[model samples]
Target: MNWQDQYQRWKNDQDLEPQLKEALHNMNENEIEAAFSGTLEFGTGGMRGVLGPGTNRMNVYTVRKAAKGLALYLEEQGMADRGVAVAYDSRYQSREFAVETAKVLGVHGIKTYVFTGVRPTPTLSFAVRHLEAGAGVMITASHNPPEYNGYKVYNEQGAQLPPAQADQMIEQVNTVADELAIAVKDQSEIEAEGLINWIDEAVDEAYLRELKSITYRDDVKRDLSIVFTSLHGTAHNLATRSLAQAGFDHVFAVSEQVEEDPEFSTVKSPNPEEHQAFEYAIAKGQDVDADVLVATDPDADRLGVAAKKADGEYHVLTGNQLGALMLDYKLANMDDVPRNSVMINTIVTSQLGKAVADHYNVTTEHTLTGFKFIAEKIEEYNQSGAHEFVFGYEESYGYLVEDFARDKDAIQSTLLACEMAAYYREQGMTLFDALEQFFERHGYYFEDLHSLKLEGTDGPEQINAIMEDFRFNPVEGAIAVEDYLTGKRTYLESGESVDLNLPASNVVKFWLDDDTWCCLRPSGTEPKMKFYFAVKGETREAADERLKQLKDRVLERL
Candidate 1:
């Protein structure tokens, strides 16, 4: 249906959710247009959007629609009886949305194990595999703003739904004619009937147990001071417990941001990748003269770190730098890594860590964009028995040290980063210092990201136009270009087109001369366009200048 018909369909529903109706009543013309112009789509990961009352918004109606689609998909696969594991974070309405999801599945006679309280997305991934469930659902927007929420689907293997599975689920979700009128079984009734059950401690215990495998240097002094903040999301208790279990007991929690504050009042945005998210943690670190400050996003699946330099001011490490530090630390320390091990990162992520992996004789692989592609590769490797997964990371503050949970896990990264800090601090150094040394050892590899937000009706069109112009129109000095959207790579010198051999996406990349590269793509989660720049140089200053030159060259044309 068109916007008018979609809006009218919600208005005419007798059992409309009151919150949704009120949101619609208060919306202005532009808000209405944005809300009804199109439905929030579920991609390889899942659907995410602002909370409101429309086809384009996230609400109970949309959550139920997604759950029904997932139920249908499971039934078609003959796996509905194996049930689904449901978990949520501390976002607004996240728990409620999770309860709604469970109810929808319950009404369809599909069993569910719902978390009584909010948990991290990684825990949910572990729960799915621990319970041997058919699937999993996590109600979170993963570092999105306070107004936003999301629905993520996971396979039984405890990874995000692969592209093929997500495609099938999307087709089923869009089949719904009217979501506002959809009804679900009562939560109390479902629990009494045993269709919905709360997940037990066994799953959490199992996940925490697996975390120990990532902890390498427990023999190091646990007295090193570290400040960890959850940014008012779901990482407080989990991080504390994991750190304590990993033998780092000197952690200081940022008191203000440790609680479940749905508004995320302390920071402008809860995203760990942003520097402002560490405001409270930095203050706390300063108070205690801590060695390192760590943070996790709302869902606790992405981690960020800031360490004190010689001047005593904290320097936040970019994802690339930290990934390199962790990669080198991991390879240099692990005594019994599997032979023929592999490491994976996305196409847009920096290659500094790749150099570290290469030094250790581990093969490096690149995925399209999301961690699901990496997870899919892990599954293939495990099945074929040709390679063992070592580590996977992305420039967007996502990392996976172990394949136990198949998704980017902040818990594991947090543990290892803390241990890394302690390991260096014992030698009178810090993580920032370790990062500089890493660059010295592995050559200076720098990566930067610039994002442009395009919201409302014209935003998507503008983004599409940008990609199209860049794809067809040639850049002046690019030696080669890879358009993942078309799944083709154009070798300019040879004028030969080769298949990209990766999943198709709305992304274009240009390979310049001398290890310099840039990638343009629309963000899968938000209404923004991201430009990723990667370059290598003899010095940090040279890399920054080269990056700026390339950035100015491309952005001026845009």
Candidate 2:
């Protein structure tokens, strides 16, 4: 049916919400056309969009539709009694969305475990597994600007529903129309029916205990003076308590950002990947004569750090650099750790990680973008007894030291980072100097990321076009181009082909001479096409220069 016809049907339906009808009455033709242009897409991660009064927007009604669909899907699986866990981050309507999800599940006769307040995304993942539930929901837009909010679905293993299963869920979401007609049990009814319960301190204690085991050297955390900031997100309480419990003496929380603020008023953006999020933490570090500064994203899954360098200046380490440092620390301090330990990272992460893993004689695995893929690998290793998973990270600021939560965990990462900083301090060296020493042992590898933001309906098409152009027209002076979507690698010079073992994605990568490579892929959660560049040289300047040139080339194509 045409979108306008669907809009007409919705308007004539008596069960549709009156407020939505009123909003539509004020909309002009173009606005109506945009609102009903298509069904809101549910991706592998789940639904995310701007909050407004449209079929495609994230409002009370749209959220109800998502919840109803999910509840129906669970009922179809014959596992509705297994229950579903729900948690929300500090974003607009997050708490409301959580309640909506719980009520919908309860209406379908499925049990629901809802966190009382905002919590990190990883904690939700852990809750799903801990409760042995059928599914989980996390209401968050992560590091995106304040205008957006998201709903993420998790499967039995506490990983995000992979693409194939997510597609089925999306079909269910599309099958619903009248959001007001969606039936949800009242909160009191749900609670009385024994389908709704609140989770609090017990879950926190269990997760923190699991995180504590990830610390290879808790002794090193004894006397660390660190400045920690949550960037006005959900990590304040747990991160601070974890540090103190791990025996750290002087953990300073940035007072301005400790409280949860949906607007994230302290920073321009809540993304830890950006330097701006660390501004307050950095200043606090200076004032307190701290050794290191750490900041977690709004969801508290990804972490970023700033350390005092040998030159008496502070340098904010990139995600790749921090991963390398942690890998080195874990490997060197592995006296009690098993010899068959393993490391995992996304394919687009810096090759320097691979180099560091190789130096320690540890095996490293590669996965696609999401940390769920890494979690899946950890599950695989645990079952097979193939290798002990030591650490996992992605260049996009996601890292995991243990399989506790089966996702990127800044709470654990923050504790480990401060311990690593203390270890460096004890040796009378800076993190920058340790990076330099690692460079001396291995080679200097510089990595850079470039994103092209394209909003609205045309955005995806533009991203596809750019990817298609690269796949057809190989980069200049490239040795091989790997097209992950097709699962094929075409050698530009040799004219040979190979198969890619990873899961399929609309991503294209080129391997240039001298270990320089560039990759192109669309943002899974945002309207952006991201480019990843990694190059190696003897010095930072030379490597940075090469990366800049390659980035320019990719941007031109984008």
Candidate 3:
């Protein structure tokens, strides 16, 4: 049916919820068209969209459809009896949506273990394995704005559904012809039948015990003053407790952002990557004379840090810088470095990480831009025994310290970061000073990310046009091009082509003669095209200049 007809059908449905009916009545023609244009996409990352009433938004109907699809897929595999785990963050309707998912799965005779309250995304990943469930579902949008929400699925290994399994899940999700027609049992009925189990502190204690196991240095000077903020999402309580349990006594919590507020009213955006998100935390840091400050996003999977410099001003560290610092600290302090240890990062990540790994005699591996790919390698190494998984990180503020959680764990990273800062403090230096020393030892490495947001109906077409333009056209000063969509790397100088040996994705990377590189890829979870640039030089000024020039040249073509 056309969008207009679909809009009318939704408007005319008597059983629609009051909130959706009110939203439908208030929407204009353009809003109606956008809402009914098509179903929200369920990709490898699962589905994410604005919160509202429509096929294209994140509502109860769409969530139910997704749950039903997962149920059918599990039943088909004869794994429904193994049960599924469900968790959500502090977003609006997150708990409601999670309960609705449980209801749908319950009606299909599938068991579910649902969290009693909000939990971090990484905890949900751990729950899947700890519970020995067949699958897992987390209701979150990570660091997206307050108006957005999402649903992510995980395999039995506690990792995000990989491409092959995701494709099959997408096929199952598409089989449900009508989103509004999926039936769900009442919550009470499901509870009475033992189909739904509520999980709380038992799992929390187990996860925390595992997190404490990752800490290596308990003898470091614990006198460091730290400021922490959850940005009004989950992780405030757990984060504070984790630090205290690890023997850090001077931790200060950002009072304004510590509570679980769905609106995230304290900051303009809940994302910790942006410097503006640290306004309250920085203020708290200044008030307490904190040696370092940390902020986690809504789901608490990604961490951001700002450390005090000699000038008494705080400098925010990029994801790449923090990853290198963490890796260096971990390897430097290890009593004995494992011979077969390996570190994993994405293709777009800075080369500095690989440099650090090489210094420690640890191997490095590269994957696509998702943590799941990194987790996939960890699982592979677990079975093959070729390499021990040491660390994993991506440029977009995600890091994984251990394989206990298949996704990024900001809690784990936060604890270790505090210890690293304290250990450096004993040397009478700050993290900023350590970072400069790191740059002096290694080449001055710099990186930046630029995103172009394109929303509405024509957004996808415009993005596709840009991708096609770069694919067929020759870029200036380019030596070779790696097109992940075609799974080939072609040398422009000679017409030689070779396989990338990675799964196909819509990413294109350029290798330049000057040793600087850039990559262009559409975000798998958002409606934006991201440009990643990295460069290294003998001096900081030279690296900064080269990075700017590379960004200018690449963006001018778009």
Candidate with maximal lDDT: 3
lDDT at 461 for candidate 2? 92
Residue range 406-450, candidate 1, lDDT tens digits: 789999999888888889988888887777877788778888888
Predicted candidate 3 versus true structure: per-residue lDDT over 40-104, tens digit per residue: 88889999999998888999999999999999989887889999999999999999999999999
In model 2, the Cα lDDT at residue 241 comes to: 83
Which 10-residue span in candidate 2 carries the lowest summed lDDT?
213-222
Off by over 4 Å in 2: 1-31, 336-339
Evaluate residue 159 in candidate 1 and report its C-alpha lDDT on the 0 to 100 scale. Answer: 92
The global C-alpha lDDT for each of the candidates, from Candidate 1 onward, is: 0.88, 0.85, 0.92
If ranked by lDDT, best first, what sequence of candidates would result?
A: 3, 1, 2
- Candidate 2, residue 411: CA error in Å? 0.7
How large an RMSD does model 2 have?
2.0
Q: Which should have the higher TM-score, number 1 or number 3? A: 3
Q: Which candidate's TM-score is highest?
A: 3
For each candidate, what TM-score against the reference?
A: 0.97, 0.95, 0.98
Can you rank all candidates by TM-score, best first?
A: 3, 1, 2
Better-scoring candidate (lDDT), 2 or 3: 3
